[model samples]
Target: MSSENDWNEDLFDCTNDCGTCFYGFCCAPCLFGSNAEKISEKNCCLMCCLYLVLSGVYLCWVPHYFERQKLREKYKLKSNPSCGDCPTTLLCSPCALCQEAREISSRENVRRIDFNGDNNQPVVSQPEATSDEVNHVDMRV
Candidate 1:
């Protein structure tokens, strides 16, 4: 059974290929004992231990973090006219028009929306609206 200090030492050694190292020399004995082969496969070390600890912490705290991120993003509103500038705002949302526009923008067939062109419009389409909503319709006609 290796101690944490021994695992740390083994992990820091550049000579060993992590893929081939055994859990007994790489991970804490208690953790290795429960899942020896699995730990050995991953070459578990101080970094892996830290990653697991951090992931556990993240799992416990992610919901709150995500909620805060949502609020922050909402408050930090901007008229980002470029898909490249605001990828998260464009991609994550459930807007069909935005999805289609993204698809079009990706294609070589479609003309690129030049950011510095006379009309600095985003390639993304306007949000969908009901039949009565004329504001949603493009005025190109």
Candidate 2:
């Protein structure tokens, strides 16, 4: 029942992704930074610091709003008519962060913990076998 242009996950469907919801609830700025970095190759640490500082004055939503807009533009996702990015980010940043995190994770094909975890294991792909690698048996022997 959803369109291709819609977001992979809804803004309020935070519970749908428990990992992102829990991580975002614990440290929203970090999640925001991760989303920003993955969305447009921005610096995660710098963004996180900025978000932390702005959060004190209740303006953390500013960076998040811009990031959301960028994400929408990058993915061609549609915005709700009644509730747009500004209002959503200003009122419910946690949810927005979770939603963005989910989108980034899905689009980038990366895990949530990979954004902040140091012990990240690399995904090793198996090499394909070439024609010369196959062994041929003697049938006349």
Candidate 3:
């Protein structure tokens, strides 16, 4: 088995994805619910309501901490020593949610296709190759 890996995104790297950062900051409960649902297939509405109720009483970070823990275990990610899960959720809830959202989205196999106006067809472009990468072809004569 391979060793555990660090989080795909850094906690302070919230600005990396503008949309997720905005969503996390603007509506934490919705983002938390979405992350919970994605991680455990839980009901988004129920999770959202739970987060809302918890936030009302000033215990909003509890669910996010648990969800973050779950995400770490599921992905075999290393734990943060400087800022633990509970503290991260408690102190930087929006950023934590943004990180989780970024992590989850990064793992999903989403592809973007562009439309060609000339032929009216969808074009799937390959990633640009780096200098170190070699294009191998088998020649049959």
Candidate 4:
């Protein structure tokens, strides 16, 4: 985690990744939906559609801001909902989206799955106990 001053990508540096910037600029909703999927770890298509619906009323930034806050918290960036997150996501939504896309795409990212464990134990099943091995009680009087 970097310091508050050290963001993964500068908000103004949209040219950092031309592909993502272009995609985000062309289709902000698609970019935001993809970013939501990665951040929330849920259905991408559904999120895309949801963003599309939200975009119609310009309410998409609400979720986008929350997701940005999550990323900031997860990555240990500055937590400035009023000063940073709000201004960034609202004032410069496209750049903000591009910044998020760049951050997610950055190699510093850790993959969701890691095979770090040494799976050396072999699979084996326990034998079932025989009925004779069970304790018997005589209660007949």
Candidate 5:
């Protein structure tokens, strides 16, 4: 009589076991573990594709479990301490969700530099008078 939440918890546990899991993308532990054969194809297929893609990338490019762990740990350390306001904290750090949120906030704060006259400030340019022209003008004055 396990609920969907129970299944999700099992999936998270299995994914966390290897330290290189795709978060909740893999099959539930109840399905992929010792009792794997009893699980349904629908549940397995729903989770497998995303996990396979992530695992493939991790195995090919990342290669080192320790390296990935280090990256995850570093992000956790650097992430904002106040999780009360940020819903993305649930995803932890170095994750796509957290990175995307950070990128958006950063972009929002960035100021656009204006080189043309469109900005509110007045544009100032030096008068193109040569030194001789300035001297002659001064003498005439």
Candidate 6:
């Protein structure tokens, strides 16, 4: 899991994957919708429609902020305290969408390739052994 204070991928590192950048540039609505759906675990088409309709707001990034925050937490990345999203999402929505898409795509691909591949088991930590579970011995000779 990534826990950096910055994004797992650079905001303008679209050149890392040109396909995602092109997709975001060609159809921002779909990119945002899919990202919302992934973060919210809801219907992609429905989220897409809602995002498209609500995008006219000057502060449309409000909704996306929540979703992007969720993605950051899900990937264990540190939250942005600089309030940079106001520009990353509001002024450059396409680039933001591209970054989000790349993050999800990279995380999903890594998950798929982990532990013999296709094995998506959660790695839970076991509790420490307790005194009750320990064996006791007598020192009698």
Q: Whose TM-score is higher: candidate 3's or candidate 4's?
A: 3
lDDT of each: 0.32, 0.86, 0.87, 0.77, 0.32, 0.76
**Model 5 C-alpha lDDT per residue in residues 1-141, reported as the tens digit of each score:** 422111111212332334223422233222222111112123544333433455454431122223223333433323334432133322332232223223323333443433456766744577899999999999998
Q: How far out, in Å, is residue 39 in model 3?
A: 0.6
For TM-score, candidate 1 versus 4, the one ahead is 4
| Residue 97 shift from truth in candidate 1, angstroms | 23
Best by TM-score: 3
For residue 45, give model 4's deviation from the true position in Å.
Answer: 1.3
Expressed as tens digits, the lDDT of each residue in 1-141 for candidate 1 is 422111111112323433323332343222322232221233435434543464454441232223223332433422224432234322332121122222222332334554545677665667878765665465644
Candidate 4 C-alpha lDDT tens digits along 1-141: 456645667787887789999999999888988988887785778877877898899887887889898777667776545557887777788889999888877724444334435784444467976665553333232
- TM-score versus the correct structure, for each prediction: 0.16, 0.74, 0.75, 0.68, 0.19, 0.69
Error of 3 at 102 (Å): 0.2
Candidate 2 local lDDT, 62-96, one digit each (tens): 98999999999887889978899999999999998
Ranking by TM-score: 3, 2, 6, 4, 5, 1
Residue-wise lDDT of candidate 3 within 57-86, one digit each (tens)?
A: 889899888989899988899899988998
Candidate 2 or 4, higher lDDT? Answer: 2
RMSD of model 6, in Å? 12.8
RMSD to truth, every model: 23.7, 10.1, 12.2, 12.7, 19.5, 12.8
Give a tens-digit lDDT track for model 6, residues 26-140.
9777888888877768678876776777877665577677777788777777655764666667777788889899988877876764343356555556797666555332323
Query: What's model 3's TM-score?
Result: 0.75
- The best candidate by lDDT is 3
Global local distance difference test of model 1: 0.32
